[model samples]
Target chain A: MTDGFVTASGVSRHFTPSLPLGERIVAAFGGAVERRSVRAVDQVDLSLRKGEALGLVGESGCGKTTLGRMIAGILPPSDGALAIAGEPVMTCGASPRKTTTRVQMVFQDPFASLDPRMRIGDALAEGPIHHGLVSKAGAVAYVRDWLGQVGLEPDYVSRYPHQFSGGQRQRVAIARALAMRPDVLVCDEPVASLDVSIQAQIINLFLKLRRELDLTLLFISHDLGVVRHLCDRVAIMYLGRIVEEGPTHEVYADPRHPYTQALLDSVPKLVLEEGAEVRFKPIQGELPSPLAPPPGCHFHLRCPFAAERCAVERPTLRPVATGRRAACHFAKTDLNIITGSSSSPAVIASGAKQSS
Target chain B: MIDRASPLARFFGEFRESRAAVFGLVVVGLMIGLALLAPLITPQDPYDLASLTLRDARRPPGYVGTAGFTHWLGTDAQGRDLLSAILYGLRISIQMGLVAGAIGLVLGASVGTTAAYLGGRVEAFVMRLIDLQLSFPAILLAFVIAALLGQGKWQLVAALVAAQYAYFARTAHGAAAAERHKDYVEAALSTPLPARRVVFRHILPNALPPLIVVATVQIASAISLEATLSFLGVGLPPTEPSLGMLIANGFPYMLSGRYWISIYPGVALIILIFAVNLVGDQIRDQLNPRLRR
Candidate 1:
């Protein structure tokens, strides 16, 4: 929390979706309604300094989107604290109006994010006009100027979202977010829904916009390659918690945790050299349901080297190196090799300990 | 947008595309013109007691009645010129329809959007209320309302408004509820704009096409409701006879073999409702491009 622009401490978000009327009636009669709490994000900590971009990468359903939502002031954490620019924001569900202008979000679906009936000019200019940043007379030019910044032509200002291609609409969305001059932009997989060719163009636009605006970004995506391409630092999440965090290049180059190792291994070319051994080593077993995560380490059931310690006690995120942390008992022993390292043959020893 | 057709040009072009709507436009336009020009078109001042002769009553069509006046459609039991009666009656009916429809649309759209945007208990309560109101036949509700409010033009308007507003409310709520969940709507909320502007300018405009379709249909239904209430002798005052009252009055003469009195106004009522309903149908089809073919 010290001097960080956006800081989250022990932020957790849980969702207990409402049951249907029939189900509620049944539950009232002592019948089961199967009401299960989904812990989308659990005990997460994240800090983003001003003008820094941190990529949150995880498999689909990991808490990346939820965490990104909390940072954007869109969703409240069920438990924990979040501060933006050192001021605590209203969280859980009621997003206070004051911080709304400070942080803006770019949605994953461009088509769904811009009103189809509204002209692009109105969509982009609404924020500036709403906050009294620019008078209505000045909003036209203000909108056009933002259009150019997002690499869109000024002619697009008069067009509706349906009139533009998917890429162009994404540009409109970006311009709409930037029009407010927000300090932080939470992009939740902004490129995932775009075409591959359009993806690079949007990514480059984001990079350029960040430089020109000196904006802080909390980027959430499942693409590790894109994360490495755009982020200065990266955090890998498993289930509802971040399993590893460090400088993007360092984590990509030397992944510390077994899950991180498996993530890099799963990607065909994330770490593989041009002729390096390319193996499709996707982690074994289905992702455990968040409804009932295993007693100890969430990933231990799938880990090849699951030790008795891994099964008995969940390892906390321990700082193993400067600016690098991993939530695995064997992280200090270098998890790339199947066998245990010298410092702790305890990994295999504990397996025998479990068997004995 | 690729088409450089100006908005005005595009509007006319789209209007031309739907032949039925164009037909509806003409029928509705003619009805409005007739309503506005009723004073100049009527040969006799039907409202004046001095303008009538009892001997002219029950005259067949084309009859040379008192003062060289000829009954075009024929005379009623009161010697009122049948054509004159219809023109004046239509004027009142259309005016009520327009006013009632406008009031109903505004009330319904506001209630619907508020129900959707506020959600939670507000949504549940508003939607349930709309459902409860809709469960009863609209005309029956109008009957009870008109009966309670007493007979007058404005009272009829109030009854029509109550009868019709729920349609707009339900349609508008459905559209706004869906639009509220869209990403653009969420993005708007994430901004510093006032909630009113977001709901009115953004949500309402998107919700309008569906409500507009509902509005056109409601206009037809409103006119019909007015006629029904008037037939029950609870709509417009007797001095200002509506098409529905005319039909009810002429019904007594039907057994006597002179049918022109009630039949003429009945035909006019059907034409008006049919024209409005067709236009509404065309609009619904035009709004959804999926139905274009």
Candidate 2:
């Protein structure tokens, strides 16, 4: 499949301090109005291929959701450009209805996503009805079919969201998104709030939908296992920028960046042999406030491999291998490779050869 | 037949069992019946001045008057039958309360929802207006409004509507504001649904229960406000005697031997207010989950 159905170039969004009560008083007293800028997303360039499931793996405050929101056009970017299927992402001034119909988002909390007062059928029928995609009677039939596709009973269409379980609500959310027949689906941790078994079910459903509908998916999650299982390619974000990105297997098997390596090592392995040695290097320190991100490399304060040069010179995402990229100066050499205990010399050698 | 014992059924059943609500329902129902059957039930047309006999005027209840048993509750200062006056007066009072409450609800819901949804400067302005209105006692505001508009049933209704709309608007605005940030609202926005549809069809319906309770309570408040205005002589015109007017006119005779003339209408007024308050309380209980259990 061709790469990049939806693409963002140097997209940035900043939220300025609103005129708070204190600020208003200060202004009245002839004091200087101090407005702080919170850069939620900063100059991030990314692309999602057609029918490809691209997982955005990051910690809670890494701005993955913000980036996803920008991609969905729910929030307008302060600067730069975003496009879907070779067309510019419609602005707020333009026909907002048309733009919203083309792209849809499934939020993290499923229960909150569906209106409690609305019956499932009404909720599902709303989009199609507003868009004039189907007649009212046709929409009812379509809603039933979509419900079945999401593994919900057709008879349950009349039920309210509160009557359903968490997983069922999420399924209803998915069904709602599917009803729009969006070209790109941006799911912001759709399974994060669900149970582990339910998470697996949702992940499987996402994978299934991706194949069946030939849809482009932007899946956001902090769970590495989930990213590894469902994503075709993975983008690792730190602060508000992509630190490492490549094919899912490549990034997991041989993560070149120090941050990527640390993340992989932190994952609890199934078994450890005697003297196999588990040097767990959990990511130290809490994330700094986005309102005032540190100078130079944002990760330099917490990065283990931080040098004098690393602190001064900010790194940009540069190509490392074919279809793979990372934003570290020492991405190729400084990262320590950890070979699997089960691997033979021949297997390791062959694997290294294949990677090269 | 249906199970008739579901949670909703139980809720309705509890409402039916509430003494206050039941009493209020009965009183309201009786008042409505009285209004509908006023012409047929009453022996004298209270509004017709020519039909009244001067000799029967100022007679107390159970008095051996010119009319005898025909005027069972006796006659007013104008020789109007007290029973007939009460029926007609109640009709005016109930009409004023309902119309005023309805106007308040519509006005409040519109203003409040608009202010909340389109926040920033609009919210501040609307909230300030609400604060200003709330500072004055509602009954005082109604009296002032009625005085300015001139005294009549419609004028009093208008006064009550003006006094009570701010309360409902503030309530509905808060509810609508809370619902606006909900994920479903955002979800609706993310879909191809129009902004108007998202705000009204999706968000407004979910936000209405609290406002519904507020509207119910306001009905009681509206009735009381109207009565207070009428008692002060700034409400309904003298031609139409509401319960408040009857009480006002009978106050002088209250000191004399005839107690039933003022006492019966006062009792009816209390019972009507009590019934309305009871129904309002039950609605508040049913709508609010914390109060339900």
TM-score of each: 0.93, 0.90
lDDT of 2 at B260: 62
RMSD of each: 3.9, 5.2
Which portions of model 1 show Cα errors greater than 4 Å? A26-34, A91-98, A270-276, A333-356, B1-15, B289-293
Per-residue CA lDDT of model 2 for A1-356, tens digit only, reads 12478889898888887789988899899999977898878889999877888999988888899999878767778888788887766565533333646778999998799987788899999998878877897988999999998888988887778778889899999999989998899999999999999998988888888888888899999999999999999999988889989999998887766678768767777678788766555877878999888877788788666666567777778776778888765566322344222123324333443443
User: Candidate 2 residues B208-269, lDDT tens each?
Assistant: 88887787778767776777777789988888878888888877887786666676777777
- Candidate 1 lDDT at A153 equals 90
Over the full model, what C-alpha lDDT does candidate 1 score relative to the true structure? 0.85
Reference contacts preserved by each model = 0.61, 0.63
Clashing pairs in 2: A4-A49, B24-B275
